[model samples]
Target: MRRIVPVLALGAGLSLALSGCFVNPLESITENLVEEGVEELIEGQTGVDIDVNGSGISLPDSWPSELPVPSEGTLQYSASIGETFSAQYEVSGRGTFDDLVSKLEAAGFENTGEIEYGGLTSTALETERWQVSIVYIDGEDSTPAALQYSIVDKDAP
Candidate 1:
């Protein structure tokens, strides 16, 4: 019984110590970028507008690139339940949803599956602590456009 008590206590301590390392995914990304000076990159790349909806963060004008001209897409929003902030990306093009999925997968996003949003089809992907959604649409000039959003949990795995 004496030996067992020490073993249990040691296990408990280790578990508590490890739990402290787990951070929210979104927070982790923000922290990492801030540390690496990527926050400036984001600000310089585009302006962002944040809208908090249930289970999602909406950005109406997440990307404003005139030359690239986002094909004909809207903002992509992603967030975890408890995350204070979320991540987003924009894609533009007119193609099958699979094409967007492939693009994200190639970009290191793990393909999860497909979902439907307001009658439009979308592909979903998830990393250890982040989630992404992608969709494509027809541009104003009939060009192809795609939109994507990557939601990173502050406490990511």
Candidate 2:
């Protein structure tokens, strides 16, 4: 847990930085080099393999098969640590949160908790192997209708 947070931070930072990082095709090469350098530095410091596919973010290669790929949003950010993953997205239209909930239920997660406070909503769901939470983070520090989500491996230690 102590070592994994920086990898998550790098991934989140990349979510915001990607647009500015890739200004043009020619500069994309330099950006890739910079990205690699950052990955190496973070890996050296934390030992987590922090791979962030920015701009057009997608699920990590190791994304657990049981998890649903979110269908309602542009991929804003994703990071994987072994089998666990965290992702954020800028959603579209209405019912995006419900869409996420329905998919997780279809994947066998049971709704374990829900809360609405301070004008934000969040839901938590879980399975024998995993637990997930999705929360609205659309005001102030986030994009409109954005969702922050994560799936934790129950057996991770």
Candidate 3:
């Protein structure tokens, strides 16, 4: 009987662990490859550098000095979208990545994809010609932050 109990317990634990492997809607939206690719594209076009440490993405020296100051728990970065350029930053806060998603949705930004990079989960959003991203730091008290960049087009009709 004791052996059976241990076996059952082990099986139950394995089941629970496996159940968590299912893709969550929020996770799906928070860690996307497409968004990462877009970010890379923007960085390449603007010649702006990005250094994403565990804390957040560091702003490059070439960044404009007049960018808005991020909230206490937020970090911001600049990038280019298509033709019109913009700045993107991240807002880190109390709640986990889930909280950031709620705030973004509340702010009228739609979830696009999920991106897992540098041991963090980044949620991506876009508005017409702009691309924004928010990354959730796993075990820190830092607030969620976003990446805001613009798209530039010289020949617009």
Candidate 4:
């Protein structure tokens, strides 16, 4: 019994020491590495970059070249549940949405259409690989406008 107790104590101590060493790598792979892999996978599948700043949603490549990012612009992972990723840039200047639309068109995107309701306008632009939406409240005193872009991999599990 004396020998068994010493062996068990040694085993337990060794396990505790070893566990600490292994946990960090496992955790690193699970959180940071996994998120990076997911970002790469999403970008590969959708051809849009994912920048999850942990704010709201991820932005696409070459966003807001001409348009200005609002002083309080938010870009992070999707806000709504079940949305893997999406991003929006808010602008407080006049004709912000129109400028964004023109930028998209110049980038080879076709103006798919526009939707209006409740004094708001949403213009959609599409390409072979992605879709972008510019939304703004019509006639609002603030002239607050937003550009929302998203890309989802249907094959992602």
Candidate 5:
């Protein structure tokens, strides 16, 4: 009878302890810390600030407010250096490269150049204050689609 109570207590304690594992499962605190440390190290080594959170990418505070950034893609990385800002994203169902292109044009960016070679496309654009580049990979069997965007201040010396 006394042994039964100990077993029941052990089981209850184990159930409570194991519940935490299920909630986070494979979540890695070390991975997050390493990623953050790498980002900070890169920022310190270079004059550029960078963000690599895959959940949602945002523009750096140093970026010019006149530029518009798309929110529909999984932001792999973002960088800001002086008057230049750039980002790379994995194209998800939420948004496509074409949608980003249209959004830029609608925001008053003029197309400066277009290039296509071997399923890759690059578009250069410019607004009154910024020069921008939009590059993307068309769908291929072996490679997932991705997009890149960059903007530089036209007047930055």
Candidate 6:
């Protein structure tokens, strides 16, 4: 666990710092790299068989394949339908959320503020092609922090 975390962090740092290398024509590969990296990390670290397309959640027949997932987290669940993708993940490390915010801001995503409903908190962001929201509950007592992420293709309906 200890060794894997540093490798994950290093991969994420490189991915963010050199993100443009995977832009445009190679965009879909970026998503593949992200998913594959996570799977490898989990398998190497915890011996868990992480599934790529095995989330088993219902999805649209034609969902895009370019959506990225976090490289250093445990995916609890995932689903896709229409032009939307949604997932729950157990993030490790203290600044994982902050790193996400920084990456999104660097990508020119507008932070449209936050929303609270039904005892859950969400931070919303928007880009030309994607609208994203991360809903979470901060840890308290014996409960650990829980996070859910949703992304939608803004151009699709």
The global C-alpha lDDT for each of the candidates, from Candidate 1 onward, is 0.42, 0.73, 0.44, 0.50, 0.68, 0.60
Question: After aligning candidate 3 to the native by TM-score, how far in Å is the CA of 143 from where it should be?
Answer: 15
Clashes of each: 21, 0, 37, 4, 0, 1
In TM-score terms, candidate 2 sits at: 0.74
Candidate 1 per-residue lDDT over residues 23-124, each given as its tens digit = 799866654444234323323333222322212434334321111222233444332222322333334443445555665576677777876655356666
How displaced is residue 124 in candidate 5, in Å? 0.1
Task: Report how far residue 110 has shifted in candidate 2, in Å.
Answer: 1.8
For model 2, how does the per-residue alpha-carbon lDDT over 1-157 read when each residue is reduced to its tens digit? 6745776667654654464645688888877877777667655765555554465556777778767866778776666666567887777633778888898998788999999887478999998989899886545544467788888898888
Worst 10 residues of 3 by lDDT: 13-22
Whole-model lDDT, candidate 6?
0.60
Give TM-scores for every candidate, taking all chains together and pairing residue i with residue i. 0.33, 0.74, 0.31, 0.41, 0.70, 0.52
Judging by TM-score, tell me the better candidate of 2 and 5. Answer: 2
Among these predicted structures, which one has the highest TM-score? 2
Can you write out model 6's per-residue Cα lDDT over 1-157, one digit (the tens) per residue? Answer: 6435543554453354334434575776666677667656644654333344323533233445554445456665454444566666666543556666667777788999987776457788988898888777666666566677777787975
Q: Pick the candidate with the highest lDDT.
A: 2
Clash-forming residue pairs, model 6: 59-80
RMSD of each: 17.2, 3.5, 18.1, 17.5, 17.0, 15.7
Tell me the deviation in Å of residue 76 in model 6.
Answer: 0.3
Question: Which is the better candidate, 3 or 5, if ranked by lDDT?
Answer: 5
lDDT-best of 1 and 6: 6
Residue-level lDDT of model 4, residues 1-157, one tens digit each, is: 6334433433343243223222476774555554555555545544434543343454444443433333444442332112223455655543666665676787787888988787677877767655556666544565445555443333334
